[model samples]
Target chain A: MCELLAMSANVPTDIVFSFTGLAERGGVTGPHVDGWGISFYEGKGNRTFKDACPSSESHIAELIKSYPIKSEIVISHIRQANRGCVSLVNTHPFSRELWGRYWTYAHNGQLTGYLDKFKVSRFQPVGYTDSELAFCWILESVVKQFGEQEPDDLNAVFDYIAGLADEIRQLGVFNMLLSNGVDLMAYCTNNLCHITRRAPFGKATLIDTDVVIDFSKETTPNDVVTVIATRPLTNNENWVVLNPGEWKLFRKGELIRS
Target chain B: MCELLAMSANVPTDIVFSFTGLAERGGVTGPHVDGWGISFYEGKGNRTFKDACPSSESHIAELIKSYPIKSEIVISHIRQANRGCVSLVNTHPFSRELWGRYWTYAHNGQLTGYLDKFKVSRFQPVGYTDSELAFCWILESVVKQFGEQEPDDLNAVFDYIAGLADEIRQLGVFNMLLSNGVDLMAYCTNNLCHITRRAPFGKATLIDTDVVIDFSKETTPNDVVTVIATRPLTNNENWVVLNPGEWKLFRKGELIRS
Candidate 1:
């Protein structure tokens, strides 16, 4: 399995600091160094950087550390390559267009027999990877449900997604992160974790490597943030662990369930 | 609108490097400097750090640069006050639990007149942000569709989510990102961008800040990675731009649409 990370904040914040720590694992700390990618959301568009090398040794990863790209919502991944060939088109954090907005997605687990059930129209896989095929399958489902026109009911759309996830989970592990330009949704069939930060800041130390940061000094009395990941990155903070076959929704650093 | 940053790699990677340039915008490079947060995925959980202050001036942000935490996936956010006050409850990247797994979500656009229609039973908002309310509303819809039992079909799930998104978009901008532990789903009603990386490498540069990195030096001959963002992060790369009303699904760094 691979790992996942995400953040939701109230202000334009830089992720370079946190990214610096993760880069070490690309080739030094952990074994996820098959490939790496990052995406940053600007006003209406997004900025994305990716590499097929270990983030720890990748020059692109190093540059990302010094770049300081800010965003309100973000998603990232590191690959271990279980299903597809190690190619650029098979990297995590894939993108597509729907309903006049950009949709980004990434996965951390493998699914069996998915190809047997997955199908798409004119959309073809740029690379021969099960992950990309799954993404296209999802898009095809959306088009089938709403046709060319977009749906007008948010609830209906979510219900449809949940249904799709449930079906895929049956095939195998199906942990995932998904987003449009507006909101974020998460599902876990195997492993996942998350945490929310609000006022009364505290200190945190990384678990995978030696690193610590005091958030109290960097934050005001009023600020809220929420993060999601496949594993716990910090050693000090109490990360919330997710059970198999679970899912949640988040926005603006808070949890909202309808 | 707000901004989002994400990183994924085969090995553990840190976000600090890219965040440095982004921090400048919190109050310097851009206007999103209301608050910030970051999350890194480790083994089965996440390590997160957040602050309400502008990252440009925050000591915590600096400390992150020096830290060496590593993970496969990382998500970071910088806020721009839109709905809700600048308080802890009103940050981005909200998180929640359902069916045992942890879920993470975030939003970039506003949802006008959403408060009146969105409603939830077992789940309620801890904050007063429209984004949170939307999240809850989506969850509620899922529960209503599938009840407590998991759906039997994956395509059905995607159809439901896409339908819900279409419905919500009618209310206003509905771009968003969501994930569980298996896959990532992205929806675009307005703007979004994404890029993928694999074996053959290339060079790229940051658009918002002055920075450049080469992938050829860091990556192996076999590697694949993808990234999604609100806007293109690099000035030299040809990032795939999302059209209005488009959505895509990703699994294991590959695209899959039914």
Candidate 2:
């Protein structure tokens, strides 16, 4: 099993505080110490940092903790390595370019015999992991239905992704975080939760470490930031847990319903 | 114009010493202060770090200089922003995956009306840069000629790339460094050079910065390393300057002719 973390913000917001909590769980407070990675989306461009080393001790991870790289969308993962060998290729938050847009994905649970059922084309997995295979399969599905151009109606694409997620969940646990820079689509097959903070935000305490941050001081009245994770990072926030087979679409910190 | 740097080695070797000199050229020694990026290939997987800030002042660049994240192939660039905005999307060392292997590219010169001359289809440019457009067109050409599978006889592919580079050079200055993890292909239009270091490695001094290193202390007798750049990175080394329209392919630190 692994852990997933993501963010969709109305403004260019940094996830340093949330990532600090998650990085600690990579080895300090949890068992997922194999590897960790994060992606920051800046406009149409994305910067990703990945390593096979434990995030708790990684020097790159330490830079991420202090560097405030702001982004509208972000995806992160910490892996425990069950299906593939612990290497850079097997690390999660896999990314591929589709329709000229970079799509990133991270998974929390293992899928049994996914390679046997999924057909892949156009996109291929560079890594030998179920997560990367699943990502390629999803991109293949998108390419099949949408071709080289994205659909005019993004809601239609969302519904199509939801359909694909439902099919993937049938194989096994398939909690995932996926984004194409503009929108973030998360599907929960087992355990997932999210929290959106806006306007009059208050102080929040981290669950993994004794760190508290006052969002009211850091954010303006117009800022809206939504964070999704396998588990809630803050102890005081009222995170909305998703039911099995449920999926949600987020853009600029707000949920969208098709 | 931007500056390009690359390394191909028989063993996993870090470019911290050379990169330190290049980082100095990013802002301290040269005027290419717009942005910078680098790609490190670990097996089949590649990790990239990009910033729209000057490499000389970037904390990420500092981290890269100190972190010994060794790799057999690397491509790095420091931008002066001729054809695109100074943003993460426009940063050099653009990459896309094809044939289940990640291919990275970096350009050091401008293209004249390349958008009108070249047509992009399967591979599209995510950023508004002539360099990215050229890379996509090159990859598209490769895909059209070889389909989704890499040719078993890689020399055939190399010849095709040399032909394509010759054509692209006709349009404008087309100095480039491209790699698919296993092989590194560098095309020179103007101002490109390379050097290969092997048994009985000697001390070298950087041209852009005050740094000296003895390769004999760091490398084994069996190690073979090749360094390529827009200009010679080290002052004392006998760098082989490539003629205009001349390109070279390197595999395991040795030149593979087209």
Candidate 3:
């Protein structure tokens, strides 16, 4: 019912080009027109911009498009309002601090009876969205299972997340993007695709807008940048769709295989 | 040292004019130019804008100045880095969620050996800053003393905060502005001032800038807006200075008393 977009890069990079394509679908090209939000991680902290307005026409979104705030990890969402009211509090890409790291999350699908099924602790959802409630439950479970310290074995953590995603998928579609400024995670049940661009990156044209960008001119030969979205933003790029119940993790734009 | 600014209003009011004056102090008029940040509460969730660059020269600050984002509670800070490095993570107006409500804080002074003295649990600081450490301690203490739920007696909570402020002030100057979207608290150890403007408002001129705003034209008769800053922002208005170790709680622009 919503759109999700995220970026992971070897170096600090801006998502202006990719975000532009997604912003168009928020209102002009597609039907998701409720609200939108984006988070850019800078080390342990993150800067977030959220607006309860159509991203295609929002002034904040316009600023984000024009100004280039480079970051190593980024997550963005455009909402269509499936479970919560259209307001600033119910905006997507919710964040909470855990393990001395800021964790940001965005969801693209709806869940049923999530409040009754999920168990929450330390982290609480301030908003009334099922997406936020699910995020809180995930974080609380992580803290409870792993104690206060950051988990040592990332593979085990990813496997745990995959199991949680499977359970959440039972209620309904569970597609999500989560990051802790270091590792970017993507879980897919219904719709999620990703593309990684590296040295041989050439021109890529947006599917929604009449815009073309030559990544070779903008990026260094060594730069590795990966973008994940609910649907492909560029028609020319080969985006790999994730199988249902599959979860993947990326660090420095490279997928970490178990 | 840093410059702190906050506002509490009976209705959702824009603090653009006041923020403009503070923005001038960030680099144009004053030396506190390491970074700046602001938190605007829109119900339980708050929207934050932070920049490592000086506010006077930041594009984000320009957007904040031009756009009118109305809020009932706001907390802002302009840092002259002393205790922490000049980066986005070290920026002031640090925020965390507790008791299902977002708590935001900004400090105007530095503490010595804060990490050694402050006791922290449950809540942790993502960034390395003496101010943020103190905030974590306060929130942790509140949770440890109180329970999971929001305290029933707000006055008791304020008193508890005042006691914690006193303890933190013993280390060094500890002027701070804290809020939970519903209540705004000001703690003073050295420099802090406040002015409440209601009906029968008059013209006010900024001390840091040449801009002048007529409050009577912009405000309604029923509007009550109270602004707290490290120093009086306006040159013509009378600002009540707080005594050392004094803490004041405000709700809906009115000072709360025992």
Q: Give the range where candidate 2 chain A is weakest over 10 consecutive residues by summed lDDT.
A: A113-122
What TM-score does each of the candidates earn? 0.52, 0.99, 0.98
Tens digits of per-residue lDDT for model 2, A145-189:
888877689788878888998998998899999999999998999
Lowest lDDT sum, 10 consecutive residues, model 1 chain A, at: A120-129
**Isolated chain A TM-score, each model:** 0.93, 0.98, 0.98
Per-candidate alpha-carbon RMSD to the true structure:
14.5, 0.9, 1.1
Worst 10-residue lDDT window, candidate 2 chain B: B113-122
List interface RMSDs for the candidates, in order. Answer: 16.1, 0.9, 1.1
**Best first by TM-score, ranked:** 2, 3, 1
**What are the runs in model 2 whose C-alpha is more than 4 Å off?**
none
Q: Tens digit of lDDT per residue, candidate 3, span A1-258?
A: 999999999999999999999999889998889999999998876999999989999999999999999999999999999898999999989998887788899998889977787767578888889899898888887777878777788677767877787888998988999998999999998899999999987999999999999999999999999999999999898999999988889999999852
What shift in Å separates residue A114 of candidate 2 from its native position after superposition?
1.9
Candidate lDDT (C-alpha), each: 0.68, 0.91, 0.91
**Fnat, one value per model:** 0.00, 0.75, 0.65
The candidates, ranked best first by DockQ, are 2, 3, 1
Model 1 CAPRI quality = incorrect
In model 2, the fraction of reference contacts reproduced equals 0.75
- Runs in model 1 deviating more than 4 A are B1-258
Q: How high a TM-score does candidate 2 get?
A: 0.99
